[model samples]
Target: EGDSFRIDEPIYLYIEPIGYTIKENPKSSYEFGFFADFTIEGEDGKVLGGQKDFAKLDFKSWNFNTEITLTFTYTISFFSIQVFPQYPDLFSHQDNQ
Candidate 1:
């Protein structure tokens, strides 16, 4: 889940674009393409990590019935560290009751 995360842990993200209906333009003359990039967003809507090498979808020779399934994978790691409390000292010297 996005809400839970361990610091300094490496995470991978696989993104896919769906539900895109392409319409043919008989009158217009233009090329179509798409640039897919990977990004990680924090809980406060901040970008923590992103991929520089973006996947490009070239549709120069593609038709209107073309189905595009652009998948991108990104590897990210957090700089923060997880702090764990030491509880061994609490029961180090226990009294017999």
Candidate 2:
């Protein structure tokens, strides 16, 4: 009974893709993956599922020291799956006249 959710809060986090060119490193493999990055045991007991999606950052037009933020949005679903929203950091508002 600890899984509480806020209707107006964001549960998903967006990751921006950084296309860093790979140079030959003597100590590391050319292609490797990080295993089991997240482990959670909050008061909310246990989480059923989660997902991640990212967009490419256009570095050609990026400022050298700019702080960029990527956003991902998701919704909780039944049957152990998360219904994710398309795109990131999207908010709908009526146009101000």
Candidate 3:
């Protein structure tokens, strides 16, 4: 799917973090962790909504693998639509009409 999404549809985002800091655990294993915050903005650049520390990824591995992928999923429902009714039209299929 493209970047544009319907109001009723869920948004799925995948991120790969490179050159992340890796530390050694007490048991001689490698440990790495990451967290993310997100914000939803309108076309006018106004921040409609967001959350801090929305997702956290932590891993302990025997090998120091640099490749990692983080997935984030979100759906806009009652709260966002209720607060920004006008915004939904921008993403809804009806907008094409």
- The C-alpha lDDT values of all candidates are 0.43, 0.34, 0.68
RMSD of 2: 13.3
Q: State how far residue 87 of model 1 sits from its true place (Å).
A: 18
Q: What is the model-wide C-alpha lDDT for candidate 1?
A: 0.43
- Give the better candidate number (1 or 3) by TM-score: 3
lDDT at position 82, candidate 3? 53
Q: List where candidate 3 sits over 4 angstroms from the true fold.
A: 79-87, 91-97
**Model 2 over residues 46-83: C-alpha lDDT tens digits?**
53333332233332322232334456464532331232
* Backbone collisions counted per model: 0, 0, 0
Candidate 2: where are CA atoms >4 Å away?
A: 1-3, 6-44, 52-62, 80-97
- True lDDT of residue 68, candidate 1: 48
Residue 81, candidate 2: how far off, in angstroms? 12
